[model samples]
Target: MNHMKRVLFALPLLVMASSAFAAGLAVTNNSGLPIDELFASPAGKGAFGANLMEGIKEGALDDGKTATISELASGTYDLKISAPDEGVLCTIKDVKVDGAALTLTAEQGKACK
Candidate 1:
């Protein structure tokens, strides 16, 4: 029937919408040092993708600032925060982003500095 066909067509779209809605990552900068770039990629991938959040005119992310990334698929990702000079400030591994949004905070410390 036409009604049955319509329901079948809409099922896939509904599933896609649900999956996309829950795939997001939020990064908060509390490292004291300014955040100049943000990198994310699948766990164990080693290579990081493009900057999810771009700085302002080569500037850095101020303290208490947050960046949201919604384009990534649902999976575990490794996150790295770096300074404007391309120095690694913080590295968080095995960040799971499943059917919900994940929040990551960068704290100030010897490891992060």
Candidate 2:
């Protein structure tokens, strides 16, 4: 039936749309210091939501390594990367993830040792 055909056609579109918006956060450690925590939350919010990667047991991200932050819905986010002793290494604001993942790196001033 024509109705059935339309439904079938729309199904792929839905899937594609969802996948397009599903790109998550990715952090690349360009700094020489190891990154112990990477947290992201909705922009303009008071607190960070959760750590995307680099936990206590798993160890931190070494220099020149990139890690992905899964389990986040696509949206604008504020990112924070911390040092091994909980010092603030870098803070990035207004990161947008629409159809592709957001990649962040610690450069110069933001790269605290």
Candidate 3:
């Protein structure tokens, strides 16, 4: 194939490939029962808002579902999660990754009443 033909053909494929895993953000809460139902939200919701994918796993607490950042691009992204209460303490911190295989944790507990 000629250079131009190859470039043109590969262009769409490249874009699609990137878009496939363009999630850019994710969140997970493995705090274990009881506390696990403390909070929930998408991992990217903290910093990027709607620019990145949002997921939540409140597990039966009506909180939400879990969010995974496994679909992020090859760069540095600040993964974060929302807190369900004040002084309650919920966190998903220091999740820096390159390419993929990134995991962020979210936890919350306080004033469960």
What overall lDDT, based on C-alpha atoms, would model 2 receive against the true structure?
A: 0.66
lDDT of 1 by residue, 1-113 (tens): 99999999999999999976754555556666667777778898888988876534435666667656546667887878777554556677887765344454543323565
- In candidate 3, position 67 carries an lDDT of 48
* Candidate 2 collision pairs: none
lDDT of all predictions, in order shown?
0.66, 0.66, 0.41
Candidate 2 segments exceeding 4 Å error: 1-25, 54-58, 98-100, 108-113
Candidate 1 clashing pairs, residues 3+ apart or interchain:
none
By lDDT, the candidates rank as 1, 2, 3
1-113 per-residue lDDT for model 3 (tens digits): 69999999999999999886665444343333222222222345554444233233432222334544334555444433333442233444344555534433234222212
Poorly placed runs, candidate 3 (over 4 Å): 1-8, 11-14, 17-21, 33-65, 68-80, 85-87, 90-101, 104-113
Q: Rate residue 58 of model 3 by lDDT.
A: 35
In order of appearance, the predictions have TM-scores of 0.55, 0.55, 0.33
Per-candidate clashes come to 0, 0, 10
